[model samples]
Target: MKRKLIAMLMAGVTAVTLTACGGSGETSTEGSAANAEGDKNYKIAVLMSHQTNAFTTAVSSGAKDKGTELGVTVDILDGKQDPNTQASQIETCIAQGYDAVLVEPISADAIVPAVKAANEAEMPVMTIVQQMKNQEDMAVSYCGGDESKAGKMQMEKAMEAIGGKGNIVVLYGPMGSDAQLSRKAGYDEVLKNYPDVKIAFEDTANWTTEEALSKMETWIQTGTQIDAVVAQNDSMALGALKACEDAGKDIPCFGLDAVDDALAAIKAGRLAGTVSQDAYGQGAIGVENMVKYLNGEEIEPFNYTECIWIDQSNVDEYIDK
Candidate 1:
């Protein structure tokens, strides 16, 4: 039913209201591309969901570096966690006649009209980080982590550490965002195998550390008996950890996205585990595929990168000695 509504929203109307502040939004990255004649033939617009966090910054940085290396004039835009802003940015890109547009959507359903508009204008559109909910056919390529598998790995590791029987709280991203939805599906998939294990509380903090901290603090104040915390992303997980730390409650916590702090947290024994989203890899590969498309080379519909479940045994592999 939700899928049907989303499809209709994408196909029928371009108007959308995007309200969630998913994370600490950051400014867009500008490419340093200047041609010999000071005239760039290829102009691309890379739109990011936000840049306030490590994961998004790595992706934006990778994309900007690669775009400059490829001699393509890239104009990166930060959507500031607003779908309306993203739609407007895409509309602006189309009007500016960019050679291609890449979007990391704030919300898949809301961003559909923008992607569809790019298709209608005959401009190539690529997606990074997350796949759009409906009208995915309009995209030329997608470069990101395998969302389905990300949650499975996190839950699997968490189950191992928790012995498959404990009450846990889940901190999630924006409800409709690809990561939030896919990660929850993975959680359910694993939870089905453990009858005694229960998700005591689940909520969305909009993928922000501050919000997650507030949620965790409130949960603590209520005296919620939680054995573990399963956060959909590192930022939220860190916030959860912070709350637990403040209350002097040491509990196993797991997160995805393996952001910089996540690695540090794992090394310091603040977190139980994390799964990598490979932000840099995805960004670089997305730009590579964009260049290939412009060079008349065909690319696959899905270019999924791999993720690793990081824990104490292998935390050293990620964190510097």
Candidate 2:
């Protein structure tokens, strides 16, 4: 039912409230593509990696809000986590003569040619969330969190929770994704300083709760002594937490992407902690920067928002603002 609702929202058939904006109660939907004046100054395309997840949905909302604020037309497109689909969308954007584009890349390598195509067409492209390979040479501006820093902070918090020594089961995102690789690098960097900390099991769950739950259940059945679970995203973290609860195990689980559920879990002492990337701000700022670029104003090459660690002690700061 939730997925059906999301699909409807994505299709611009209905409106939905966005999360990750605290409790300001601002509403946004995919249908709001025009400015308040009803005459758009520029037509921009906001291509998302996927619209199914809370993070990406909030991003889409942010882009829409910014577009409305700036009196421009912003069309939201879902990539469905496929590079080919995103490439095709870019081609469509080019053929339609979009004034600018904001891309949330799914694969760093696969997105290069598509971005290059946009460049050849003389269209401005800004990347949000995960960056593509050779980012400087491709996207004109970037607005998102530092994946490496987020991973480092998440691991450090988990390590601190587990007393710096334990067997951790790491839940990964898509195997070769930019977030997966860079976050793993950060985790490895942190593990280097703590020799007692070992990775007992690690695999990609594709950033989904169901897959993470299934994998964790199998790990439990195998009798692996998992001291903690570190998930790449909040959805997987919640799944891992559920699996542990079902198995009657008390495990400290950590995650990135401090979504609302994760924050509530932290408040209720179910989740250990998560890293905040300001998903909404990333989308809004990407559009804002793209507008600046289009208006012949100088903008920063890389615009990264703050990535902070959220735990029980500070979860209230992020919940229901």
- Model 2 per-residue lDDT tens digits across residues 41-120: 77788888777678888777777767666666677877778889888889888888889888888898998998999999
Q: Which lDDT tens digits does candidate 1 get at residues 265-289? A: 8888888889987787777678768
Worst 10 residues of 2 by lDDT: 1-10
Number of backbone-clashing residue pairs for each candidate, in the order shown: 0, 0
lDDT of 1: 0.78
lDDT per prediction?
Answer: 0.78, 0.82
TM-score for candidate 1, please give it. 0.87
